[model samples]
Target: MKKIILFPILLIISFYSIQNHATAVTKSREAYEKTGNVIWEIKTKEKLVAITFDDGPHPVFTPQILEILAKYNAKATFFVAGNKAERFPEVLRRVVKEGHEVGNHTYSHLITSKITAVKLKEELNRTDNIIQMITGTKPTLYRPVAGIYNDVIINTAIKNGKFVILWSWDQDPRDWRNPPANQITRYVTKGINPGDIIVLHDWHGSEFSQACQTVMALDDILSYLSSKGYKPVTVSEMLYRSKTNYPEPFYPFR
Candidate 1:
């Protein structure tokens, strides 16, 4: 009787341990799924870089940035928040009219990791609707607020028919901190290479001064990139032009 009880107890303990270990492994994989499953850059030998701006369609600064881009005969991608797009429909329209690409940056600029799946879908769908209403074309590219994401965010975006977009060469320049325009330009242009996706901001909430600084830096940044023989293209264009086989819209996970 002692041996019989011991054998069953040992089997039960082994089963419990195996279950716990599997649970731990699943959790670990989910956590790892957050950061690595994003597209940072495209592989290409072509002298092209994609300059992207987020939190924009600002009533003031967006036009200035567009003017600078036009002056350089360069194209870029603007990841506009739905709220901002609704507020500044003309600005958003100008972004499309001027031959630049538009991307969805969520409806309310909510952080993806902090929201529920339903809320995430709402955010993306709302933004897509607004963009489609304004531009007659929904955005296929999606950039998460603050560049933070997770498995849920990625899956939600893909489900909503968006390709998750992140930058490859962020050298942020802390422009949102109201740094000098030259500093912002240096941070972006320094060590910038082909296939790099640069992130700049055209809006800074109520900080009009910081927005002005971004505009100020644009001319210099454009000039530097032009002198280097680097043509600024939209993210879609970069991906299409890339020589390497990049996964469409999402990064592959093993």
Candidate 2:
């Protein structure tokens, strides 16, 4: 009787341990694949770098950034959050009017890896709808929140007929941390190469101060890129002007 009772208890414990271990292992695998599967940069011989701003349409900073871009006659791509765009439709309109490209950054900025396929589709579609409603243009490019994604996220995006974009050059400068403007400028301009997709943030959550630093840094970075004979273009333009047949939809499903 004791042996029978012990056998059942041991079985239960073993099953629980196995389940926990599997969950941990699965999460680790997802992280590895997420970083590995993304496109870091487009391979081309053109002197063009696509500057992409994410999580934006900030009422204050976005307009200022646009002015700076205009002063230099440069174009960029904004990966805007749907909710933010809806809240500030005028800013969205200005972005379109200024000739910059817009891409979807989801509706609520939820981390895509933690969400289900159905939830991912909803997030993307909701944002795409808002962007279309405001700009009258459907965005073909999608950048995942926090730059996190899994197989489900990628597959769902492709199924929805959108291309997933990740930056080739991070140019982070920890601007979200509100670093000094010169540091941010240096981080972007230093060692910048052709066909590099640089990522910057125009909106840092609810705070406008961080965006101020980004604005301050923008002129210097743009000046340096211009001095280097690099033309800043939208991601699509960079790909097209390179005269190379860059792969679309990234890796196709098998």
Candidate 3:
């Protein structure tokens, strides 16, 4: 009687936790919608999506992730910090050389919510210079560190000629926290839809093992996307292929 009672209780608790998580994600998407000039996800029915990796140019794990992406012929975007790119120029170059999109992730990965507009501009310029120095083309996309930004930050980025990018709310698996590989894979693969943007980290400066776990999840994610007849493209490509679906529904949960 105790075992049977506990099992049902555990199931109820698990379901409640998942519901809360989904609600939080929905709230975040609503907040993002209020912040104009950000592209969280495109709206389309063409079976295309974008994969983005942040804080990267890791010499070890980045190459591993790249290998996995190449295996599936999938294209992604890398939002690289200037300090890391400076340290791992070869890895950064390899990311661009292989046809992946590169974006500015700021100079030192400073959290945008706590920084001033001037400081943010300085960070963005420093990162753009580093990326241009290595890749020969300035990045047209910018994703602030920690996905924290306001209208001021967004306008600042626009003045610098960048379109601010954010990932799909449902697609985040918190890989930086070093969750299990299967959990990361399931979260992403399950939430996937046409025009969705999936964010994963390729380098965690202090959490070395976290990126390795992301690399482990990448193979499975790509395999599942391929099997489902989905095409993984760069964020730019997704935007280009997007339909003119205007004023998405208030909830927009899929």
Candidate 4:
């Protein structure tokens, strides 16, 4: 009996190990166009990292970040809050127009738990309708407010037809509090490896232009990482690179 139990236990462990190691393959290539950011967030094994921006397509500063990203020809994921989208519809358009991936950040920026299933779908649908109207493409990625996700929120999002996206790591500089550039860079450049999905803000709009640290500091971070042979692809790229069905390599960070 012991032998029987031991064999079964080991078999279960082995199956889990393999499932944990399985590569992520999207059966729907059509899913790729809309779900690229979320797909990459969950899949991929490459040395790619998705540098994601949340909170805005801010009225003023988002354009600055866009200019910088454009200069590098880099791709990123932006989770735009729905109300912000409604206010700055042009910015939302500019995000997609500029080749950045956009995902739902919620309609009112409410936490996932506070919302009922009905309200949750409404938030997602509202954002979906708005984005589809503007870009003619419906988004498949949704990040709950502040990443405060639960089973209900996840299920609701999926039912509303979105992939639940949360970060695997955290590198936030609390740039919202306006930490120094070097401090911010340190948080990012340190503890960083391949397959990291870094969350940065284009604008918290908190009088926190402290991201100015990155203005001078980005080159340093990029140059050093480049020397280390790191390729900073979008978060979607990292998900695709992991090919790991599990979120082992995630670093959902600021």
Per-residue alpha-carbon lDDT of candidate 4 for residues 1-254, written as tens digits (9 for 90 to 100): 99988998999999988865554332342353253333323444455666777777677667777776776666678888777777778877887777777888877778535566778899889988877787666777787777665545666777776766666555555555556767877888787756666666655644344445444555566655666666666554455456644332222221
For candidate 3, what is the lDDT? 0.82
Candidate 4's error at 26, in angstroms? 27
What are the lDDT figures for the candidates, one per model?
A: 0.80, 0.79, 0.82, 0.65
For each of the candidates, give the backbone clash count. 0, 1, 0, 26
Q: Write the per-residue lDDT of candidate 1 for residues 173-214, one digit (tens) a residue.
A: 767676898899988988798889888888976636434788
lDDT of 3 by residue, 125-149 (tens): 9998988899887887889788877
Residue 197 Cα positional deviation in candidate 4, in Å, after optimal superposition: 1.1
Candidate 2, residue 150: Cα displacement in angstroms equals 1.4
lDDT of 2 at 198: 86
Clashing pairs in 3: none
Ranking by lDDT: 3, 1, 2, 4
What TM-score would you give candidate 4 relative to the actual structure? Answer: 0.71
- Alpha carbon deviation, residue 130, candidate 3 (Å): 0.7
RMSD to true structure for each model, in Å: 8.0, 6.1, 14.9, 12.9
Candidate 2 vs candidate 3, lDDT winner:
3
Model 1 lowest lDDT segment of ten: 245-254
Q: Which residue runs of candidate 4 sit more than 4 Å off their true CA positions?
A: 1-45, 206-220, 241-254
